[model samples]
Target: MSQTHSGTDATGAPVNAPEHVIVIGGGISGLAAAHRLAGAGVRVTLLEASSRLGGKLYADEIAGVPVDLGAESLLARRPEATGLAREVGLGDDLEPPAVLGAALWTRGKLRPMPKGHVMGVPGDLGPLASSGVLSAAGLARLPLDHVLPRTDIGDDVAVGAFVAARLGHEVVDRLVEPLLGGVYAGNAYEISLRAAVPQLFAAMREGRSLIEAARGIQRRAAASAGGGPVFNGIRGGVGRLPLAVAEACRALGVTIETDTAVRELRRTPHGWQVVLDGRALAADAVVLAAPAPVAARLLAAESPAAAAELGGVEYASMALVTMAYRRRDMTRLPYSSGFLVPPVDGRTIKASTFSGRKWGWLGEAGGDTFVLRTSVGRHGDEADLAWDDTDLVRLSREDLEAAVGLRAAPVAARVTRWDAGLPQYPVGHLDKVARIREQVAKLPGLALCGAVYEGVGIPACIASGQRAAADILPGIVAAGS
Candidate 1:
């Protein structure tokens, strides 16, 4: 039974109106959906299992300077994230990185990241050769791609296998592995070509040189957008995006309750009933935005096929170690933003970001303090994650010393561990996602959205949420009438 209240629709006549919507999960996706629903004059209630609203988009302070503890930037080429930031009054705060360019800490030295490459698949051999990221034999093997037979990619293929067949294993190990690992935290050879990098996969289907395909992608993008900044960040931290969206939702009369986990979902004759500890809330429409496991549990009874698929989704764990050091002590820091380390090199950390140099706001806030962060552990390489925070921080410091020759002890160090944070998109991931979506669609007034179904970036999550909200709007309106 929905608790309806008196309200006026369009013409000003008082009527019992507005369908109730219960959005499970209070992360960016759920908050975005609730905001849209409330804006459309639907009664919205959002529930989160955790104490916080932002999931991976978290913010904190280190040595009295504000910083993002989670994701640091948004893909600006995609409008969803930046547009939502502006909608919630963060337009002026959208900023591009102050420092540009990154290097690879491979071959026992720092090498400039090769230009004209899509995720480390080089389109031009000149830059790759000059960068010295690959061995002499590796460099010689790349020309073979022009005359090599097209590698058959049926429904899907691993990014590493496909690239290696055309190029060489050295390119996959030295270049592609580290670059792709930074995003998925999974082995490049295990990740899906179609799901992970759709544009490159589509080009591969054309049966031409992989280099030409990458060049075409680059040229097309440059011509269309004039090579705009690929990413953007908020003035303070990207984490603040969810907070601002939550605020906007509240202003629109959305009821948000944190630490309120939904126990189960039951389909009723009129609508759906959301079960909690001792009470049930009726909703005309529902959006399931929790992580895969939690979403699986809630949908097991109603949609077993979707639940099983969601349960099978694999996740990768990683840790971020952020340290702040006195600017006076940093004598040998690299000029670039930071660098990525190939796993084949036997390095403890995968990547590092110079927060102070990359984000101007952080640099301004820190004053004499220089802040940077290092990431460790990935899907199958998570043994080090079991180590205590102290160990993780020490390992990070050691890698920093070896990479940039900086031995100064940090004034303050912080370690953040995300267990099972990133989901892996293996071969046939697109088909799996399609099956899950199909099974869920069979249930009326229900939809699902999160990092599981589509891309895992900020803009992608927001777009998924917006799509979910749009999907249920018509059903919600009809139910209320």
Candidate 2:
């Protein structure tokens, strides 16, 4: 790989030298890019806007335990997150949650999630019928799914509309919205069915009915002779994975600047010019691994089309309240991992996880202490986000008490707010992404990657980063030729 540092000394004349690459943002996506490039023998520099390295994958020491403030779990079925963990030598740290069961807070009670249900759409009705979470009328309403006509609109549709059309409105309001609400932190009325659950939609497109598709899936699983895997988390915390990645990047001799934020980018006859603080740095190639909005601001002037397309993507704010309590003070303890509250319930909290119960190692073994994590706010729920930490904690505590009958005040508490955390995959999201890609392809030596494009989970972010690295490395190597 070529290495170079060149700019105007005191005059405005350009100077020629070997090429070096610069990556904007130090999140997982950016870190992955820099790590990949440096491992391939390319001189790379990584710039982060914050004083710390991890963007959303952040953790802090609380009462002698590491508490994750951002992402907390990874899907075992997704290989990208697991593969990256192994590459960074943190694979041994992988740990599964203690409980595989989840509950739903509905009709003034906490009910266990029905078995054989994939995100609340029952693959097997036996469990749904017996679960008692829904009324007999609701259960009777489900069979209507088989008679619903196939939607042949050939255009993007909202998740709520799609679910209500195929399944009943009860399923959309009581199940799908809340389950998906926990994932995307957005309203199901606006979230795109194609972008949010492409597999489910594909099943509909192929089988002509959700019931048949679900039955087909169940038969396939039974034929495999084993059930699917459950969700997993790290033994220590989710932050450990990012820390390991940072360590590996450092060992590879990649230059990481934590407090350095790239403010602007200007294209030159040679490659690209980046402005950080008040200084300008030139690079042969640039990879924008930041959030869509942030990346849009940087490229607004250089590539108008790309900037407009990127700016079109929307994001919402989310907040998490983590609290610890004494088990003796609580009258009832849920047997499941925790519960999700549907919007129809008119609850302030979206979901709550029994951290100590969900994962065996999260709390002291056979101890009296327990930890619970609650989430709040979304696109239209910014009022909750605007609340002070104290108010937020109070509101969450009240909601927990009513929903689960836990009367004790928390022994320990911490609140973390993300102004624009989860990206909203609104209707026509895939088409917008396609347009963004088309515009990005028009610019040479430039690549964009992050959760905004493909997925919003840890695995998807890792995949985006690796894909960006693959696209840029060969060009960096060939530039020297």
Candidate 3:
């Protein structure tokens, strides 16, 4: 349930005016904010350019079974998403992965992923060797991290460069690349360490052994969670989250308008005005939950500096090929949950998840068929995306066959393309976001929040949206008073 707010005057009477906030965008972030504001008795008018809500979180049917075409898992360490799910009556359906581990297909073999890692930064060297992710020569050089002279990273360094300096190129190429790709779809060499893995970056700044630092961090994480699940998913699908939030918004009396794009956003004498469907909708405040480019265009006139900064924020496009196969096929199942393919592996499919093994619920619905998803086309891989869905499926199967030696035709297949789906946090990205936020602060009643500003995870996006709502809530109350 949304929290209550104390907005009444000392005598518990009406103030200057009713607080009204116009929220732009219909993604998870915007929906969450609208829900909160509405619960606080603030009239909310939300404008979504698309025909439906849930920007990237989507649920669809495949072979008569409900499935998610976009993000599917939630990091349980963060309470934002899981907490909201409970508030929306999804608490009973929360589940963790059945299998806890994954594999890596690299260097002409399938190997177990090394354990004790903070995004591929190894805390223990034993698993790295046992997993065969690195060669004997590669393993030999890991100890040099102790003898090698200390390296200095000024403000921030690329994750690849920093890890390679400490661990080795092999670790960055095979371990870090695929791990980062699962979320960023970008090269590890260009990802910002400070932004992507802050704890590890802080460890590096402490001027100690990264291995020891990783172990310490891992111990703290384990102690904090008390050995609970690290990740969770809804029984139906993660895509259901947005729908629940939207329904809650409705219950709170939020006016949600779909296919209503905000074409113009201008500052008025009172506060802010948004022109949509040829009519101006004015409100005391505005919350921006759109993508960087969309937000940039909307705020260009009011704050050109912020708009330019947002425009510079880049994005990565990718596609998913989901296929269901009959269990009778003459093949074997992967021992682990799935496998990740590093970009250096020279394969078309970047990663494959054994949904059947990972999600026990998927087995309950999928009686005779085993389902899995293959992801392809990361950042700087435009040529791979040029192929149509059919060819994409073919290439995915080809790569799957080479990796797992499964030639059985898929009983059913579905391809979903996400053009510029995820934002890319290159080096110095946090600084850019800081500049954008600072510039936006100068404009009254204008706040921006999305995957571009802080984080790309569902929880992070929700937090960002809630923060935006909180930032303007005080001003909205004061203006009304």
The number of the candidate with the highest lDDT is 1
- Residue lDDT tens for model 3, 1-481: 1223434344766434337889999999998788777866788998899898998898776787677788989999888899888877789989998965899999998888888988998888888988989888788878877777666677888999888887789999999999999989998999998899888888878876778778888889999997889899888778999999899898889999999988989999888889877699878889999999999999899999999999998899999899888866725867678899999988989999888778877767777887889999888875798899999899999988888888999888999999999999899999999999999989877888889987999998888888777766642221111
TM-score of every model? 0.95, 0.91, 0.94
User: Looking at model 3, which ten-residue stretch has the lowest summed lDDT?
Assistant: 472-481
Q: lDDT (0-100) at residue 373 of candidate 3?
A: 90
* Model 2 per-residue lDDT tens digits across residues 214-240: 666666655653554545677677777
Better of 1 and 2 by TM-score: 1
Superior by lDDT: candidate 2 or candidate 3: 3
Worst 10 residues of 2 by lDDT: 472-481
Off by over 4 Å in 2: 1-19, 217-228, 365-368, 475-481
Indicate the TM-score of model 2: 0.91
What's the lDDT for all of these models?
0.88, 0.77, 0.85
lDDT for 434 in candidate 3 is 93
